[model samples]
Target: MTSGYGHGLDRDRDPLRRYLSAWIGFSAGGHFSQALSVAIVLYAFSTQSVRALMGWPGSLAVLGTLVVLATLSLVGGRHHIEWHGILPVSLIALFGFMGLSVFWSEYTWATVGGVAYAVGFGALGIYLALGRDLVQVVRAFGDALRILLVVSLSLEVLSGLLIDQPIAFLGIQGNLAEGGPIQGISGTRNYLGFLATLAVITFAVEFLTRSVPRRQAVASGALALTALVFARSPATAIAVIVLIVAGVALNALRRAPESRRSLMQSVFAVIVVLGGALAYAGRSRLLDAVDATNDLSVRSLLWARIRELAAVHDIVGWGFVGQWPTEIFPYSTIIAPSGRPHETGLNAFFDIWLQLGLVGGLLLVVAGTLAFVRSWITASGHPIVAYVWPALVLVLIGVTAVAESFVLFEGTLMTFVAIATIAARKRSWRSRLPQAAGR
Candidate 1:
């Protein structure tokens, strides 16, 4: 494969080639890869280690690493990123808004750090997209996921079968307690499911590409499926299923005539807008249908409280930093009254509104959706080499957004990377471009 920028990669002789190769090799992925930062943070969150280490000077070590990596990935690049595209601009705007929010945010220090975190991750994402091919990025994710899943499974086994006890520090609930949910090394069953969903999709793409041996593919698929089944998260289950369906749909879309595809997309967009309007208009009736009033499902009740919280800070939101601290004003004041843990918005869009208010939140939604849709359109026409990758990743991320805060959150650093890469202007730099430059 060739470099997108005109350059020879004949590392056997050229010192410059060797340097570029080494730079990208570590920066793109592996043990010392930029992804390491993300892995450490997820591990901390999964094991609830951060909470345990609260007040310690090195508590945010993982997050600190993440920020450094993100910043380095962007600032380390010799070539300036072209920020005109939807992918770059949306990310800049999203993080930029959060940065600006520091002026008005109650938690000023947290907001400032949060902005740096967002942009830092955003920077890494831009590098990944602009510098590498879809296959390489997927491989990096696959490598990281393998280690995570292995660690997670080991923890589950230790807690459930071997030790026959929950590991409170690691948040492993174990398989005991008769009908209890299995959290493994993840924070919750749903989070495990979420990771597994991403794994299966990654494995699927690798399988389609035939990049790995058949046995390895089969093993990874089996592993992901096993984890998903054990997770018991309805949302994660729906996400994986939707990913498969969307993949098949993208395949069909790619095969369609070029002109007709745009027409089809337009019609679908119209239908979606109308359906959303209808749904909003009859939301009360829809909520009743789910028996949410009496049962108060997790999402149902969370939404109910979110509305009230959002109303209190109608225009500019309470803050755009981290979670509403349990001890803080609006959060502490509302928790007992609402009767539900004021954790996350559960829905990405709702959460943004909770943090950034109506205007900022709407900007976040519009920018992100436009970027996703633009990627979708680009994938519809590009050759399968480019198209299938973004199509699958974008759809998976987009579908999963309904139930997961896969964007606009620090914990979702990896998701941000994936989203940025897929949404960036892509190229087949894997072969022709670099070779052309060499010649």
Candidate 2:
């Protein structure tokens, strides 16, 4: 009787142990982890569509699910993670400041929610950086962008050609037939253009690295260019010009002798500074050249109001709301000329100042600057074509942030976190410590 009872207990324990082992194996599988990474990217980029189709509750559910899966994968693959120098201290500082803002926030609950949202995406970004190789991350981005762009174009064709009406639900204007200014799945032409620009970079990297077939890369590039042309966003057009110049500079630097590369970098920095000054001085002409004069007029009005209001909370900020809680005080008062309540401050820097104050704004600057510098250096020295992707993506983000506040929320925020993490992992000084030496 005693032996039978012991055997029964053993059988019960075996089933539980087997189940745990299977879950660990599944989560640790290469294919499973790669698919999850792609899914996270896809969901991040398609957040607008997800919200539109499934509502906030549904979208949040999806985000939560991805976070859970990512956590599981990381745990299962714990052996691969280099914990010594994984995350940049700058990022932690910024996030910690955001959390601390809860004390001073008038809208405490909103700030709490906002911080949670920001951290959720930040965690997902960390997962991508730590869990996959840089090349694998690029390929995942390529796959996700390909699917998103194709769907965006197909939806445009359906609404603009077949139905001859807007898909108001998805914010698609059905303007493809009208020689768009199309809004694809991103809800605005500028956003679509931005995504297309990112896709162009990713697809190019994919081609350069031979991560995907040549024909596929060429076709993807063509598709991205098509989306960009139709989107007709002056901001994105400017970003593309900057991207081309940066790409040329990076290529040149990469080919230069190692000793001279430092001098070349300094020269490029001076040129960039001078170019920015010249662009500012020629602002009127530049605006006219891009047909963004009207857009500028609208933005100037909003920015003026933001400056006035931001002066009220110039230090710590009103709170850490990522996307503006337009229903609240101050934010509610900043209406666009079109009578619509403004959702963002239009400029990311201004938005940060208004929301998180100068402290948060400075933190952001430090984080972004460090990330770019590290990525640029890594790309210049590394032979792999894949390293170029992070640097170029940062350029796009920095340029676009001047006119749009997308970097502070959702997909752009997540991308920034991932790239920053990757750059830190590669170039952080902490990596030299004995604990991190092998990693």
Candidate 3:
């Protein structure tokens, strides 16, 4: 019973420490995933002529993850593997492409890169969800996420505000009809809008779970919301606002007396249905209202184009990221000077649909949806933690579904799923501990 750190062999361990270590490890895994995803993306487009190559650090990181898995398997034995919750769905999404990949993909290298991306994202998501206290880990990760957003948003703002090269740097190539700083990251009013919505959602959830002063939370939330909006990105902000209202409405009903709770819930449900109807009816206005009109308008064009492309290659795809240029052409009117087409579809769903086809897209969507839903359900009792994080994740997923296909984007989605899995695992451990003691 010798404790590794101390002389006392019998000191009882703190569950919190175990939870934190696992959580941190899971978070680091996500960072690694992001770095890897970036490497893959950069490498995919990198021609031997241009010389955009991945360095030794990235190679070592990938090698390390493999080493860790190999060592873990060797020591713990492979049979100890546990595929918890929605992992199977992700596996199907990633590996199922193999069937189509065998025939359709023109270039073997591109196909390999595509598979690598899927495997990376799938592995990270499954590991986080099934193995890690992903809830707290996610909350902690939010801190870093916010900082990144702030930096990204700020960089975008400067490009739009202080600099003259708006098109190349900021990606706001078209006329800036709407006022304010240009949106960065995804670019365009709608792209920035969705990113902003995610920021607000993340901030709100973290704010609620935090033990910080109410004023501080409010100030921080307001600042984030402002910065997000300043980029003229409405999609992310709108999603956050909608989720907040939904969550608040749900909370109100839960705290109500048992008799009134049902009635309130029913009323809330009706409101949601009515709201949905209104949103659909005034989708344009709603988009404009949130300064996200571009998203609403462009999605239709992108969907049509992607569907047509998929029809041609119904099984696999045009070879992962390569399909983007060809498939996106129908939706895009603007051509780059380099002869590449530029269409800002701004929908993650379409991105996947074009890359993986119908079957893969469906499975990945289910898996991603389940990632948030599981977190939401597990954190139900801890309302502050459960509601916000899952809600934030949902908001991000929703926005991405419309604008970008992040299903196999190893960096962001993988990190999120990993944190979520960690949270769920912790809950399971706690529930079983007492039962095991009794036995």
Which lDDT values do the candidates have, in the order given? 0.63, 0.93, 0.51
- Which structure among the candidates has the greatest TM-score? 2
lDDT of 3 at 311: 78
Overall local distance difference test of candidate 2 = 0.93
Which regions of candidate 3 are displaced past 4 Å? 1-95, 98-103, 126-132, 153-179, 184-195, 211-219, 253-274, 291-298, 315-339, 342-345, 379-387, 419-439
- Cα deviation of 232, candidate 3, in Å: 0.9
Would you list the rank order by lDDT, best first?
2, 1, 3
How badly does each model clash, as a count of residue pairs? 4, 0, 27
In model 1, where do residues sit more than 4 Å from their true spots? 1-59, 66-87, 176-180, 266-296, 336-340, 411-414, 426-439
lDDT (Cα) of model 3: 0.51
* lDDT of candidate 1 at residue 69, scale 0 to 100: 58
Model 2 — which ten-residue stretch has the worst lDDT? Answer: 430-439
The Cα error of candidate 2 at residue 394, in Å, is 0.2
For candidate 3, what is the TM-score?
0.65
Q: Could you tell me every candidate's TM-score relative to the true structure?
A: 0.76, 0.96, 0.65
TM-score of 1: 0.76
